[model samples]
Target: MKEKTPISLHEIEGVVVGHRDGHGFIVRDDGQPDLYLPPNEMRAVLHKDRVRARIVRHDRRGRPEARVTEILVRSETPIIGRLLYENGVWLVAPEDKRYGQDVLIPKGATGTAQPGQVVVVELTEPPALFGQPVGRIKEVLGDIDDPGMEIEIAVRKYGVPHQFSEGALAEARALPDKVRAVDRRGRVDLTDVPLVTIDGEDARDFDDAVYCEPARVGRGKGWRLLVAIADVSHYVRNGAPLDIDAYDRATSVYFPRRVIPMLPEKLSNGLCSLNPGVDRLCMVCDMLIDAKGEIHAYQFYPAVMHSHQRFTYTEVAAILQNTRGPEAQRHAALVPHLLNLHDVFRALLAAREARGAVDLETVETQIVCDEAGRILRIEPRTRNDAHRMIEEAMLAANVCAAEFIASHRHPCLYRVHERPSADKVELLREFLKALGVPLTVPDAPGPRDFQAISKATADRPDAPQIHQMLLRSMQQAMYSPHNVGHFGLAYEAYTHFTSPIRRYPDLLVHRVIKALLKDGRYHLPVLPVPGEALAKLAKRLQERGTSEAMTRSRGRPSQEVLGWEAAGLHCSANERRADEASRDVEAWLKCKYMREHLGEEFTGTVTAVTSFGLFVTLDSLYVEGLVHITELGGEYFRHDERRQELRGERTGVRYTLGSKVAVQVSRVDLDGRRIDFRLVRDDAAGEARPSGAGTGEPSARRGMAASSLRSAKRAGPKANSGKSGTGKATPARATRGAGKAAGAQSPGSGRGRRPRG
Candidate 1:
């Protein structure tokens, strides 16, 4: 009897990630390698749709190719796009190119939106094999050129909760405008203590205040530091309307000129904010640090504080620089207190260096905007001693919070950052070796090892690039119940104990601390709304392949542990969501800013090297754009993955990270958020000229150069077409152009400092 043919199909479940070029990828739920879905398989699905797919076969390079077998869930997110009327048919083209297909709008469904106006559309029907998705206009967001339109689009696109629920708003409105006598009954009265809040000039919400004094610790001189954080838990009770809203938002999203707060303005800006000369309830971390900067003793307590003064970072820096200066004379009474704080900061910094913490400095730019929300210019934000002083104080309190919860055997979310994976370490080693840098990585690396490499390469011309690579190799920090420790800060335990007014995780920490103080357990109650939804999304984003390993390490977790894990996951996902939304708004603004300088020439340094092109950051504008491979002369170029460079085969000219090159702006696509550049060749020296030599005028040959570049790109490369030097298929075109060009941090409310972890 002839045996049945062996079945070779392997089914996998994953989320669809669409590309601008119509192809897509299935990011497996199991955390395995992603499966490539050709353009045909993506026709029936949109971005972020979950589905079950059968792997038909593997390519020659061992990459899996899949076909969709079943649709699990269609995304419920509303699409944000520009309404277009073409050939007598109404349609909406998604601002996010990953959607791949336009949504068809029926004649009556197009609300009050004009043809070219941006609008939000709710899908009425999902896409089929031969049909497009259909949607109805739900909201009109005004014209494309309207001021603050980018932020409006970003909030909706990332599913950011911008508006507070009615119930939440009612609860906030019912709260007292100031801390009352009844509220101070159970709290220690620290109103007599001369504490102050130092933050950025633009800071609106003051979450923390600090004070320091000299003390005696075991026959040695020490400092007593008090960090007071806004007591948000005192007002936002568990399972309350305010609590639900805060949990849904998870964190506040900061944009260029706006902020979508987690709590209502009544609480975030007025009631909970520790504004100067106001009676505010707070949770204080009172600590005794020895001369060596080690925390000798600590205690947590609720207190009523009256901020003596409000100081900006710039003002504080000036005062500290010259004690007898006019700025210090204005606050002569608080000058000594500031000096004490500075003393403690120095000791803490010494301890940090001794412990071998990873401190990679990066250039963070702040956008200067006009009254109409147009970009005036971009400037690098300068950090001063005042910023570091407050940061160190907050870090110490966070560490104490983590230790306090762990000591009580209570479950809480710990900010954990694991070591780099093996593959990432190997890749980093290969890159360093190719650059002839002397470094040795251990089998199990730690934060100190990475810091050592940074110090050794501090004098190198490519130090910035090397430091960035090190930062990228590290894993992202996330909240988790399991204490894996933070690799970057070299801390055995850490948690967010500051900024409860803005971050939900810090509020949870406060509740846990309060419960421990009362000798009672803080049981996470069942949330009234979106509990299951939050848990599900958190599991999808956080569990990946770690769930099995967690089960293996420890038997099945109890229900309490499970609840904490879900909360951690939800908070982590929302943090990432907030970051992405902020970045998206910034990118849109930068694209708009670059459109006015389309034909100007500028010298820039290569910030990133990829298979398709080099990402160059302009010296004066501080803006980044792409220099496509085809624009790098006529010789065939091959991408070296290990060295992160592109080398020409005929002339052996290489363009690697940190290389300086002159390029003229060739094209700007505001819709695509892309800026393309053409290399400006120095025919006399056959090398790139130094920056500042550009005439800064619109180039006359800009159109001719753009046309030539496009023609060459269409003809494709002569050799190594569709492949890298390692014989791997070139990555998706969308991966190379999007998100890399316009990367900048938003001007956040004094919370822009890198997290301690």
Candidate 2:
């Protein structure tokens, strides 16, 4: 056989990074840490281009930045921001921040859209010494404040699309509403087997169902496990409209009050949905996982499984708890087995822990709406046994999916989170040590070490603070071709083979699995249409933006040598987008909800402490309202990042995340998508005059305030910090620390705090 050439040796021709994003192209070269583009040498590279370059002189900070020597290829397409007439000369600001400059829109170049409105403008001319690229508006998206406007803004801002092609839509509409008889020809029929879907009460699209039975192992041990995933590939063929759309999206974006689904509603909520009593096709992961939580043997096959009951998390939890409720007797026969399933879940959960899986339980909030589309509640939904049981089952299936795919030599999208770089991990360890939590092996801190640290500080009142820090220390996960094991989940190999109905990655995995089963080369997952294109644009913009952000900062330029940075950036941005969208919707609804109770007070906990203000989660309403830093108390407070707390200089009363207090709704700005909460003591909240700027500093201090607040009224820390403070792990508490010296909060940051009646 001929020797395979190293990928590094290949000359990638015609590929160029746009020096100016989505407008013109430029050459970009490879290097570590910061990839530099020489001022004049940055002529041809676009946003993302893979080109060969020669190393120039090192930067001032000792990084090997380079200039592009040649162009390899151009990225997909150009997407420009809306153009507007400024003074007399027309100018349009690029929606993408990476572009870094406004494209000069000449007079008569703009379409019907006036200035201020975001639009898609194309470049008519490349950058010249005197003039920038010229462009005209292609489509006009209204002012950013329109209803559901955030989603549209995000889509345009991130290059995500809202419309499916007429062909794709037509393709979906023509498909049958239910699984055709011929579709189940070769699948196993389990319609009468009593499989049931257990999900949140509001879950409209069910993609999974479980049914467990006790079975004897060879010697005398026993096992109980059954995980059935919607068989997407069985019904949706490769390259079909449904499959194509799903592949493009790769994952469903669940923003509050809305869902941007990978599959169309028809498939997501109807046919492909695993609704109760429906003969839905499923790709079942039938396994005999023993008490050790080890999968003894597993098989994957297409089957027709009927979900006998559609149970909500609340209902299932009640049944499992044997509560005297309607659901307890509704599924009476299944209660015992459900409890058995919970036991098996517990065993598997223990097994997962034994395997060094990092169980990070972050709080998840749900938005509740009334008939008028107003937010009635924004509760922090606790993870009941039902949710954990589902999670455990999914985790088991994902592990098996990873093993099976690798065993079959198949390429697929993996949910991978790599470990932090040695330096960053060291910095994190230093931060922990400075805060009084010492790390035994500082240099090489892995998931188990984190778990150990968490366990050690489990009982501390400062547990939430420490857990938040540890989580921030870890990288976020993303889809990848290579499965190098999930660093966060503590899995050796893992892929999302469940939830094909909502997540595009899972759908793609199904396609890959089917292809692998047929001994075919697995096709690569596509970024949904503009999805990939937008992702490429987003990545370039993010890299440049992050690099720019690094300068004039405290921490070392994030070690790009750690591939996890890219993963983290992607996930973090997605998380931010999801958050922004969710918050926007919830804020709108909450603003509407709060309109009815403007003068009423609600008990809330300080879920977060930031320089900008404190975010309070109400106890009874489950709604989160913001108390501008000015609303904390009638005193000056300094924000301590190292300790993750806000301290009052006059009162010595520090408020950190988990602090409890009562607050009256001061004001809700639906236009700005912001809610203001004043202290329970605020007497003239509505009549009070506007204050200086408020700081948005995250709680990194005041970890010990929980103990102090016991005497004072507090809400949450309501039940517990998501798994972060679980067990007995409690880090040391010192109001003062080594590395970071506390700084006074900027006067502007103390915006909302005012004396209430």
Candidate 3:
């Protein structure tokens, strides 16, 4: 052991950060940065392995310093995530932290795991003599069950996919794809129907088509709207490859960069995609509605349509708004019809409003990435009128489809959103009462009830908070063969009859629509065999969920975390990964871009608060960076999770998520995906008033101060002391870049302050 080492401090265990030349782990000693764990001695240690280590040699650079004397814990594990048969051997690769090397299962222990299948494994023996670690297969998941399955596998292998299957793929490749002449013999051949598909500029697969014309109801005073959807089942018959894949997927997985479609490309992109000018099959919902948006007459049929024009929402909106320039003229023939469509949409919107449909208008951030999958920027994409207009049309069409299917006495999967859980409702009720917010909830407050409550608290200062709470109190919608009216849409009946390319349920609905039109009975999907590898996947997912649910009750720790149900936790974790990956790619690009401005000032919002630091969200560019709370001022700042605030001891000023402040770029960590910032007064933030500061609603920045609190360090620099080497404070001018009044200094202001390297 090295002499002069701080004696009697807790014998700190070492954590392996990296490995070198089969020698051992490169461990780090926390308190002292200039020390590391040498190899050969660290053979038992692994990455993230905590060990009892002591200082042997302190390098001048302060790292490469320690020798691990004992392995406090074994880092190897039995349960592994990615075990499969490879090169005549069963190899188990774990998908967890620590990233340990793969374990090879003996040929004698092959069990049920197949080549190219995702299976869990258990290590029986550790690696020896240059041979891999050994294990046996525990379970296997079927070939990534479509889109949802891929995500599930990806997340799980990451220790996170939150989805379930209904034994749908068990009945695979049993049916045909193309509609036979015998199949078409009984169905209506509405090949001449003037149905057109309206989608986005980038849409590839068209699911539903519409043919709306003027009609009179209630004594000829209302207009009749016809909503026709692509009859997908006509082409993709029961038990076909397309059907099997679709059913397995359950839903489409839409990644930011690409989509793993539920159906095969041959089917999703070719046979059933409903491309314009092609003679495509579809299930039609013909509804005769009045001016009051009530359906007076409706009919369901199996029909064929040659989509007249594949119109973009932008083009439709342009025609409807009468900005018929060259772009609108490109699709000139549909102008009058599109206008009539807008009229229908207007009426539907009114009906929706009258029904008290919630206008949940949260903007979504679209990530722009470069060729190498690095994020270019994060910007809010506009959901223009065209988007809403198409949405209204789809909603009406889905209602008509659901009503037609139900009226015909056929059973099908319904998109159902149940009322909030009893516990949630009770908690919300108590919370509302405490906040003095009056709400008249029925025995069960549905979407309309939530809407009423939101409207009541609209103008209140706590509107966002209340709205967020109420939103959280609602139950998420899910799919079931049971027909329960949708609560959120305020509809008596609803099913997804659109977007079959993205959702398997919608394709199933289309199948049922065709089945009923031809007078056929509904067939149940087949499930996996008992004790089969596939069954283990479903069972394993359930078990994984149970295990995770137990951990959620332990409460949260760090940032990028919220709640912990199996599904919720999985989604949250995946969301964090996605966000981090996106942020990493963006930060790399942004840092490369921001290198142009070394001493620039930018305005930002306080996005998060922690005991150690605050995260600031830049307003102009939307880039986020950390502002260590320790750098708040000369005095101590205390954090209060209850009030979501950080209070200054003497100034009494508080900072929270929405608190506005100008910050100067202090440092950047590209590989670590971090951008550091230091808070600046408006005067130092430059004349460019962050566009809108006071416009943002005030956050609850109410908290207590850390008055008279002392640092854990004997002589540490005060917060934001702008110091350099070994706790010497960086100069005020260099630290506060854009120029603000010099901050106050204390006894610990200039000496022994640590810069987070």
Number of the top lDDT candidate: 1
Name the 10 consecutive residues with the lowest summed lDDT in model 3. Answer: 748-757
Which candidate, 1 or 2, would have the higher lDDT against the true structure? 1
Pick by TM-score: 1 or 2, better one: 1
Candidate 2, superposed: residue stretches over 4 Å from native: 1-31, 35-120, 123-134, 367-377, 515-757
Ranked candidates (TM-score, high to low): 1, 2, 3
Model 1 Cα lDDT, one tens digit per residue, 41-130:
889999989899988876655667889999988988789999999999999999988899999999899988999999999999999889
Each candidate: what lDDT? 0.80, 0.59, 0.55
- Which is the leading candidate under TM-score? 1
How high is each candidate's TM-score? Answer: 0.90, 0.68, 0.60
The true-versus-predicted C-alpha distance at residue 620 of model 1, in Å, is: 1.5
Query: Could you report the Cα RMSD, in angstroms, for every candidate shown?
Result: 5.6, 12.3, 15.3
As a whole number from 0 to 100, the lDDT of residue 86 in candidate 2 is: 64
The runs of at least 3 residues in candidate 3 whose Cα sits more than 4 Å from the true structure, single-residue gaps closed, are 1-184, 370-374, 404-411, 422-444, 456-470, 482-485, 518-520, 529-602, 606-617, 622-651, 663-757
Output the lDDT of residue 304, model 1: 96
